[model samples]
Target: MVEFAALTYGLLASVILSAAQRNSKMARPHPPLLLYLGYLLCGLSAGAALGLGYIILTRFIGH
Candidate 1:
């Protein structure tokens, strides 16, 4: 599932770049930009999971 999302985003980024390269109006993005965004998203998800786990553990421990 993760691989699919990563590959999908990567392909989308490539398509966007190719289209922009063919036209003059599209501002060229910084190279390798969207990949960083995807990675950040994955990290955020992991962080969220960690936070949730901590909350659950603390609740259980308090009882």
Candidate 2:
């Protein structure tokens, strides 16, 4: 199960990325669905990374 920190990080990153995409004038963000999909992918990745980093820190580095 994902922890609170991971969820928080994912949500924060998603919000930031979405806002950045909106404020940008590039045509790369033409499709809104793509941006939402990107957010989903990013949140999943960030959550996974945070979870793994936490595990490594607590198990090996003695967090």
Instruction: For candidate 1, report its TM-score.
Output: 0.49
Candidate 2 lDDT, 1-63, residue by residue in tens: 559876886777777667667757564444676567667777778987999899998999884
Q: List, residue by residue over 1-63, the lDDT tens digit for candidate 1.
A: 989986976776576556556553556554566557546656766987999899999999878
Per-prediction tally of clashes: 0, 0
- Per-model root-mean-square deviation over C-alphas: 8.3, 8.6
Q: Please report, as a residue range, the 10-residue window in candidate 1 with the lowest summed lDDT.
A: 22-31
lDDT winner: 2
What is the lDDT for 52 in model 1?
88
Candidate 1: segments with Cα more than 4 A from true spot:
1-31
